[model samples]
Target: MMSPGSRPLIPGSFLKIMFNQAFPGRPGVYWFLQGRKVIYVGKAKNLSRRLKSYPRQAGFDPKTKLLLAAADHLRWQGLDSEIEAILTEARLIKLYQPHFNLILKDDKTPVYLTITKAVYPRILITRQTGTFGPFSSTRTLRQILERLRHIFPYCDQPAGSRPCFYYHLGLCPGACIGVISRETYAKNITDIQLFFQNKKKRLVASLKKEMLNFAKAQKYEPAQAVQKQLEALSYFWQARVMSLELPRLSQDQIQLELNQLFGFRVNRIETYDISNLSGTNPTGAMVVATHGRPDKAQYRLFNIRSLATPNDPAMMAEMISRRLKHSEWAKPDLIIVDGGRTQIKAVKKLIPADIMVVGLAKKPDRLVGVNKPLDLNTAAARLLIQLRDEAHRFGRRQHLRLRSKTLFI
Candidate 1:
């Protein structure tokens, strides 16, 4: 239970030990126990940080406060990624029916992703029973389906002669018009099944085998298409992790917090990160967030030209310099660099004094340039970190793409 004094129920040393044993920085689900009964269940993208932040969260909901008061002990199970964490959290909540998972337990509120039992299965978001999930976040589940549909197209429309809107966009396999056969459509459904089951490794292996067989048969076009799919899948998880934020933070709440933190209304935020492997194919990414959410249309990437070594600060400076030259681009209220004081120092001198700049340092994640005290537990900090991570993932993918191209050359 939460102590009457300042001490938390889970000791810092215990959390450290658990993390060390489970693998540090792993994402997973955690449960709160009141004696023998499980009272609450939650998922975290980073277990170590999430566990620590709970005690610092000033804006916790009423349910959270109630759970903390009753929870005598805590336990967790770490997983590979955020996707696994969400799925596992849902399964555990279903099994335990935890008292505090009130919104998740409601059949009408949370989304259920179903593959309708039909000749050509229609992927759907419904409140009824589902094959894949009773996913807690409706918006996230919708976005997941949209992303996956582009990779493995399937029909979501009613069976008819007319092709659906997605069919015209090449996001549906044309099940309505018989452009895809039952056997081939079944394969697509199988791939989706594997994906929802968190069997990405198996799905990838199968695709590889199929590609190999296609190459052996001299079906070069099909093999190349499969290769592209493989590359997309390679970067999919990293990109997905950036987009999926559990409980889905509000843009208004984040901006309000930032307004207080900076003493200025923050409407546009730009975050930068440099990615490289052994100083080869170094790339830099700039991601923007307007009104407290990522604006992907404004995202930009740079291939490091000025530096030939792993000088992140220099690369970051170069990226900023180029970005500043674009007068048409909307000016940012805040700029977040993914490093320490050196990174901030590198780019700060180049930018206008009117624009606020800060760095998000790791090991112990904290803001570098800001004079005000930072509370990592706040939604404002989380938004900044998310944008930084998005930039990192974007830059890394661009780096990998360059490296892969060089290999073929």
Candidate 2:
């Protein structure tokens, strides 16, 4: 069984041995285990710092307090990046069905926007599968739904005997009033799906195409209406995309953007990642950036031994904690992890509140921070992306070396 953070401090020699033999403290997902069963699952930016905060008296949330008291041992995975951590934590929570996660077990469930399975289907808030989100901000998504409803009006209720109240408000186009044809309403539903899927570019392109078709058919007035709606969507979605928190443009640029975005001077940017063959041949890497360019001499690598099983969050957390323990290492102004929410949570605990933590999640790639997901259109985000890629490359190299050495035996 693992000790709680408030129990006692770690021994010096043990810390050294752990530093030598195990993975570096990096961002990751952790489990508060009661024997073999997981009672609760959580994530962090630094595994060491996060776990270290779990003292019996450490003022955690009520649910967390209960979870900590019941926890016997801990199991964790250090991850390659923050976004991966978020995805991994969610996946683990679903797979394990831990007792304490309110999101899973609660009756007053988180809301999801669902598209109905009907010819003239309804769009409604539901708890069903294949819906939009388990969003923290219901108001935000609801507002978006409301706004989108204006541009692409669809039925808010299933096929009804008479027109619903929303149709009069222009929130729905009165399919019940026979004012809209099936094919025309179907196109609006498709547009709604496209917007939710973050296919704004495709949706805009299609809208432009449709507008041109209208103009070509000498339907000038309809074409103008389509143009007006398309412009409105582009403007609104662009505002939502927002400017990204970036790095390595210039020393002055870094300071200015950091002050405006994350509220600090971001001179030194550090990125962490992990590589492994499933659970074996595990290696972790940290790459440093001074201003906008990489500082090659400051790069570090580790062959992970903390957990024999592959756990990306644990591996990353171990790496980051070890790094923070070293007083000699230069402190970073901003720390970038290669994954999303889980990765950010893992690292944020160890890092000072002033120092920003950012996660770059690939596959519909986004640069995410604590409560901030911004467009990755700027030069700084691109630079961070390169730095993360470099860390992964270096970590993979070390992993391959270790695997080959093992194979030779």
Candidate 3:
């Protein structure tokens, strides 16, 4: 990855250094500050990873650049869980009303969880405030409701002559069909409300008390249901809300996996591709990925000054050689050339022994010019293929633009 110190001096350099020095890699909320004013607030499942991303992101994104330039410092607070981070971020955003947070987020209205003031109060998501929240992340809030609904089985629809869709799905307690009394359904709603209020302890106590009461009365069925709810709730808390979000590999996880695969700590990867049409208007492009995400600002396109032939390996070599001359540019920990063994051999000669080099071959999509065998199904292989494809896309576009210019010339 590009070291923050190696980059040109820019606004928020101090903040970047501070972030690198020691930000906890845990769930938390962070603030970007302009002097004493808090200009933006954001939450992350991993604080250090998210905060460090801003510096690289600012290189290409106008809004990120502007926000970082305007900010002088940063602050963060580590939280125990992702749920806590989400809740704390919403509360802080509300309290500070940060300028960049609102603007960068496009001033979208925050979502709220509201309980309707009716005979059978329905839990809902709305723009207006009512009972529970001005949650910052609508998707996350919805996911939370989905998970909790399976446990509490509250209603989102009005009481009707027939059972609602959720009632059939067991996500509602059959209040709409009058199978469950209003008072009993109300108790479920209360539990949900208490959950949104962050009264986990009180909610657990209430459920425990109800379970004991049912057991004492010999109502084994209701007692067993309550016991199941208690067990599920316990598992939910221990699960850390990760299930609520879609499952995807984090960049850190990807990097670690790649590290294990390569026997080296892989951080920065550069991929090169040559694009040409019968030796005419040949172009070579380099695509960079730092810390497992593309850093578009560092992408370079070469006009292929030294080669007019359609020799891909030679063209690839020329590009790598030219790129290496610029010592000030951040060196990649790994380099991927877009060809089989021959292309890899040409580029590997130019790179130092310490820096790793590999080729992505098209047939069956495997790694070449390296001793390690990599499975195409693995995350590490997928990332390499993704970068290789990006290189091809970038080089092909530049080559087409050059060809178009030649038409007029």
lDDT of each: 0.75, 0.67, 0.77
Taking the tens digit of each residue's C-alpha lDDT, what string does model 2 give over 35-57?
67877777665676666566533
Per-model TM-score versus the true fold: 0.53, 0.40, 0.53
Rank by TM-score (best first): 1, 3, 2
Alpha-carbon RMSD, each predicted model? 15.8, 25.5, 19.6
| Candidate 2 lDDT for residue 195 | 73
Give the candidates in order of lDDT, highest first. 3, 1, 2
Candidate 3: stretches off by over 4 Å: 1-13, 33-37, 69-73, 128-133, 240-242, 245-409
After superposing candidate 1 on the true structure, give the runs of residues whose Cα lies further than 4 Å from its correct spot: 1-23, 34-38, 57-61, 103-108, 240-409
Give a tens-digit lDDT track for model 1, residues 1-409.
Answer: 1111112255335434433443236777788787788888888887778867654452355545555667667777777667767767767766787777774354456567788778888888876456665677877787667657656788877467898866644568788888888988988898888888777789999999989999999999989877867765554454534453422667788779889999999999999989886678999999998987789999999988988787889989998999999999999999999988999999999999999999876423467887876554466766776787688779888988999999999
Residue 164, model 3: lDDT of 79
What local lDDT does model 2 show for residue 164?
Answer: 74
